[model samples]
Every structure is written in C-alpha cells, then in structure tokens.
Target: MRNSIARRSLLKKTLTGLGCAAVMLLSPLSLQIAHAAAPEKDELKLGFIKLTDMAPLAIAYEKGYFEDEGLYVTLEAQANWKVLLDRVITGELDGAHMLAGQPLGATIGFGTKADVVTAFSMDLNGNGITVSNAVWEEMKKHVPMENGKPVHPIKADALKPVIEQYKAQGKPFNLGMVFPVSTHNYELRYWLAAGGINPGYYAPAKGDIAGTLSADALLSVTPPPQMPSTMEAGTIDGYCVGEPWNQQAVFKGIGVPVITDYEIWKNNPEKVFGVSKAWAEANPETHKRLIKALIRAAMWLDENNNANRQEAVDILSRPEYVGADAKVIANSMTGTFEYEKGDKREVPDFNVFFRYNATYPYYSDAIWYLTQMRRWGQVGEAKPDSWYFDVAKQVYLPEIYKSAAAELVAEGKAKAEDFPPASDDGFRAPTNEFIDGLTYDGRQPNAYINQFKIGLKPDSLL
Candidate 1:
C-alpha cells in the first residue's frame, strides 16, 4: 500500500508540472478560450452505489457523453459507500458518486485520512427518513393530522415520545444512517435535534466514535440497500437513506417515510462526483472532461422541467445501475414521494439534478458539512472560521466546475445563465430555510454552529 501511494504521489507531481507548463505556454486569450487538453487517461472506471442519485454518471455513460469527450468509461455498482470511496482513494476507480460529506471528511482526516476532492455535485434532496410500520403506528398517534392523513414534513418530536416509551421498557431505540459522515447521518441528527431530541455525540478524542454519549436515540451505520431489510428484520426502528431505499420500504410495506432532507434543509447538497486529489492531480484534463460530461447529463436530467425524468428512471432501473424495480425508483425519482402507502404528495423539488446550479460545488456546501461534523463530536476540537474556509477551499473545487461549464458554453452545450456568475464567491446567501427555522450563513460558520440547540457549540468538548 505504501509503494502504491508513493507511485501515485510521484505521478501526481509529474502531471502537475506538465499541466503548469501547458498553461504557461498559452497566451491570455488562449487561456481564456481554450478547451481542455486531450485526456491523459481516457479509459476510466467509476464507482457508484445502487441508488437513483447516481443518475448523472449513468446518464453520462449511457448517453455517450463520455465517449463524446474521447473517453471510454465503465460504471460499476459497489457494495456500499465505503467500498466506493476506498476504491477511489486506491486508484482502483478513477472517481465515484460519493456522499457530500465523504470528500470533506476524508480531507479533514475524520474517518479516512486522504486528500479527496469533488468538482461536481451530482444531485440534491434525494434522501428521506423512514420508520418501520411499528414505529410509525406508534408515532402516528402524536402526529398532527388533516383529512385523516399525517401532516407533511413530520418533525422528529413525533418520534421522541416513542423513543421514550422504548427507554421506559428498557429497550434501546436504534436508528440507522448510511455512514457516520453521510448527509443521512447529519440530516437525521438535525431532525432529531430540531425536535429537542438528543441524537448523541462522538468523542473521538477519547476513542469513542460511536456518537452515543448522553444519547436519547442511538444512530448506527447501515448501507443504503440494506435499510429496508434491516428495519424489516427488526434491527433498526427507522433509517435515513437515499432514494429507492426509502421508497423501497414503502413498497415492501415495512416502513413509512416521515420527512425528506428537503424538509430539513431546502435544496441541500447530496451526492458528489469525487476523486482522490492524487488521481485528480494526475488526470487534470480527464477530470475536466469527466465533469463536462456529467454537467451535460445533469442538464438532460432536469431539462424542460423534468420532461426526461421517466427516461432517466428507465435507465437507472437497469440491473447494472440502481437495479431496483422501476416503479420503486420512480416513486421518488419522477417527482412524487410516497409517504404512507397512498399518501403520495407533489414534492416537485424532491430530486433536483441540474436546476438551481446543483452541479456547481460551492464552498458553502463543504462548510455546511464541516459545521455538522463540528456540531456533532466528529471534529474533536474547535477551529477558527478561517480554518473552515481553508478546508472547504481545499475539498470543494468550484474553479474546476467553472472550467467545465465554460467549456460547455464555448461548445454551445450549456448556457451561461444556467450557472452562477463568475463573481460568485462560492458562498451562498444566508437563509433560514431549515425545518428548525434557524439561519445558516456559510461565511459565519461558528455563529451558525452556535445557532443549533442540541449540537456541541464552539469550544465545547464532549
């Protein structure tokens, strides 16, 4: 493993030098208008989990966008997020569809200490929290109802009393999330915290990464595909996971989805197209080409107000891709998320791909993940606001995204208006668009951290 890493490091330096030389040779006008150089590595293997949000990658490959860039790409479905991220770090896969937190966490040495970065965010708002039928039945008594149906954007307060009941009976209330640093985990924690429930903390300084200190509810890791089965088998009472899995629970008649991450934070960033920094440095042109193809794929996914979503659903249902039943994937992919068996509602933004600049990886998105990491105890020490900015700048590469978008615009493939302005500082404007109604200004990360009622505030140790 050391030798392999050493080899990648050497190749990265060589490629970096070559890229710098090529840039130096170009005139200012040429630098401004030039398309990407020919790919250094064209035949690439990319990894993704069996989830509907991996649509951008599948669409890129299936629609020949990759081939259009003189690249031959193979898309493989990994067993889980760990396998997918590990394969990318090892160079076994050039890149992968990753959790938004994966690259940030890896860069900060949270779980795996590796320099991972993302230039393209795949999709947004594709996750939902679902509880087993037994839990939902108990929770429904406390949920506000209108016309014999549970209210939308159900709060975790409804589940809080149920957890208390389990505690009273001397039973542990277990909830599953995909990974510790996953959006699922943070979203679950956010929902629980919003309702005044203690979701626990991680004391990594003391080697307790379980995140269960002073906990009312215990959260654990379960891969996306196994969530429904895990809940059905009575291991976990509920789970927070990405598409098809949450919908799978409803289809299997084992669970009912309570709320979506959209309800938690509107238009929240979800999956990203991530590669090792070594791999990215070693394959700059190939990386840019890859982003271009994915950007095109994202445009296709959200074209004409999702007119092409049915086709996207068809492609994502193949055995090589998500491999779920088409109807199950379509339950959320095509715009309506089924909460209860028949309580489907129109959540048009439930799965956003290209619209709202979803593909542009903003620094604010990276900092949001870091804030959550700090809010929980994954980040053991408090850092200055500049530290958060520096870390986000390291992991989220909006410059590369702009390069890809510029190339597309030069080629008449995408419009300039569809992207953020060149003047965008990569920090989104502050807004109180959360289920808890607390404002988040990415520029003021510590203040945002302080706004939370249940998380560890600045300088607070577990």
Candidate 2:
C-alpha cells in the first residue's frame, strides 16, 4: 500500500508540471492579446499637405474609421512638407501624411536628423509635370503631332531645345519641385536626364545643397498650391507636383501638364504615414491601431472600382482638406486626367490607394528612393546594396503592418488575399515601365544608378 501511494504522488507531480508547461506555452499569446487592447493614447493630431493624395487621411477621419478604432483624430494641413515633418519630429503632431522619401530622408540626415518610421504607405501615382503656356507653345513646335494632337507620353526630348534657347538668350530655365528630397524633384530630374538635360546635383559634403551645381535647368522648391501661380507669374517656367494643383493649372489656364509621374514611373509609391521613432516606440499599440485604421481607409478609397471617389472628391473639396474646387479636384481623382485644355484621357490608375498592394510599405520602394538620392548626390557617396537594404528595413516596419493587417483579416474588415502574399520578402519584381525604358531591380541599385548617363556616377563625386 505504501508503494502504491508513492506512485500516485509521482503521477500527480508529473501532471502539475505538464500544466505549468502549457501555461508557459500560452503566455506569448496572452501578451499579444493584451497589446492589442485599447490604445494607450487615442486622441491624436495628424498633419498633411494640401494635396489630393492626402485623401486616405481624410477618408479615415471622415468615414469614422479612426473612431471605430477608438482614435479621435484631428487632421490639420501644414503649409508645406518641411513644416509638416518638423512638427512631427517635435511631437507637436502625432503623425503626418509624408512624402515617401521623408522618413528615409530624415533618418539619413538629408534634411533633418530624426529617426522617423512609416508603418503605412498612403497612395501612389498622383503627380504630373507641367510647363507654362509659353514653354508649352515653344515645346509644341518640336513635339510630333498626330491628327492635330501631340503624341502621348510626351518625352522631355522635346523640352531640350527649349532649354537650349533659354541658354542662348542668357535666360535661366528655372523649374520647381516641391522639396529637395521630394519625389517631384527626383521625377523631374529623371525626366530631364532621360532627355539629355542635366537637372542638377547636390553636394552636401561641399556645403552646396542648392542642387543646381551644374544644372542645365535650375530646379527649386515651390509649394503645391502655389505651383500654378508661380508658373503663371513667371517665377518658374515649369513645376512637378501632385494633384489637384496640376489639375488646378489646367483649370486656371496657366500651364499644361506634359507627363504624369504615372508615365514617368508607373504606379510609383507616393506618400506615407510617418511618425517620429520615439513616438512610435512610446505608443506601440497606438501605432499599430492607427495603421489598421489607415488600411481600412485605403480600402474604402479604392473600393468598388473607385465608386467612392466622387464622395472623396466632395469631402476633399472642403476648405479644411485639399481645399481645391471640386471640379478641379475631380479632373484627376475620378480616373481621368486633363493634360492640355480639352484633352481629357482615361487614366484609371492615376491615383491608386490600395490596389496593386500599393498600401504595403515595400523595401523595394524605399530602395528606389535611396537610389535616386545617391544618383542626385543627396547621399554624397555610394553605398553598398546591403546598406540600402538596412536603411529600408530600419525605416519601414513591415512587422507592424502585417500585425495590423492580420487583425483586419481576423475581424472580417479585409481579406487575406488583399495583402501582399505571406511569402513576400518586401521586394517588388524588377520593372522597366519608366519613361526611359530602363529596368530597375531594387536588389541592384548600383547597377541601376550606373545605367544613368546623367547624374553622379558611383565613382564620381562633386
């Protein structure tokens, strides 16, 4: 009987140990569940520039998506990209709709030395390059016309001779981009370089950040809302910017948009939702929840073949948001773009928010921006492929994005198929859809940079 009692005591201890092991196994899930609870901070303020691509932020606020996530968000419009980024860095704003390049630029000390991170990519492909009427009239002479209309995807080759004439007359062919590190600057530079015109360079190492060191066409900053008027006043001959400023130019008859960035680089990533790294770290749960709400907002924007775009346009027309006329904003927002007066074309993918996995913050997207920075001398030195990968990983938090997306899927707010494939390594397939017809694989940034006939070479420095 004593032996039987000892065996029973041993079995009891073994079962208790197994129970303890099970609890340890389940502990991680419990912690994750706790992290997904109510946000640490709910009432928030977000900033954005007054551009149509800022639609996702507006949609999230107006559609009650933030409220659904228990976030009371105040959406404010900053005067320009610089102020918006500065405000976020100073913690005056919780986050902001930022240039896809902003977080990368800030982190790398291009403009500001701040550790900023983006968990969400806002939208893609909503920008155009426009020239004043006189420049367009001059360019028309060189452009090939078919049946009384200039051919589509008007190459900057036609603009080359015009710049030459300006040089001949001792006139500076001045152009404008939104900011130094903006996509507008790079796209304008890319288009000009493709056509054999040197847009310029930046030598931060030499204390010359003007970016016009040896430029054939001088490029400078002009805020989006002022693009049309600046060109109209002859302060700038042309400008590259996002809508509805480009469309506003068409409506106001100040200039004509020659090429969309969609043509420059098809479906290119645009803006992102950026917060200071400190802010993100301090409020991890809030950041994830905010991303979830933004994802739902992006889905709503692109839903039903963009049947909701008109509503978005209406909402954006309010003075507090984009503040442009509804008609001008609709010119590009509703799947059509007016290039020249009376020349409307169907460009359904002109402003993609969610489709094509546009909302996913791909490392490939970040790498492409870094490549442009190096090509333009903003980086001032060549970096290895692994360096680009490291910077991209540091700025873009795909783990946070995935967790947010997973929650949406579990709650039936989104489908698993709607996101990047579970196996995606954050790199997009190589694409050659640029107007220059050169292929770019983010994995091979150096090779891609070397292919450019213009801009700084890997071995060449200012």
Candidate 2 error regions (>4 Å): 1-36
What number of backbone clashes does candidate 2 have, counting pairs of residues 3 or more apart or in separate chains? 0
Candidate 2 colliding pairs: none
Which ranges of candidate 1 are over 4 A from the true structure? 1-36
Evaluated against the true structure, the overall lDDT of model 2 is 0.91
The sequence of per-residue lDDT tens digits that candidate 2 reaches over residues 181-296 is 89899999999999999998899999999999899999999989989988999999999999999888889898999999999999999999999999999999899989999999
| Candidate-wise lDDT, in order | 0.91, 0.91
Model 1 is weakest, by summed lDDT over 10 consecutive residues, at 1-10
TM-score of 2: 0.92
lDDT of 1: 0.91
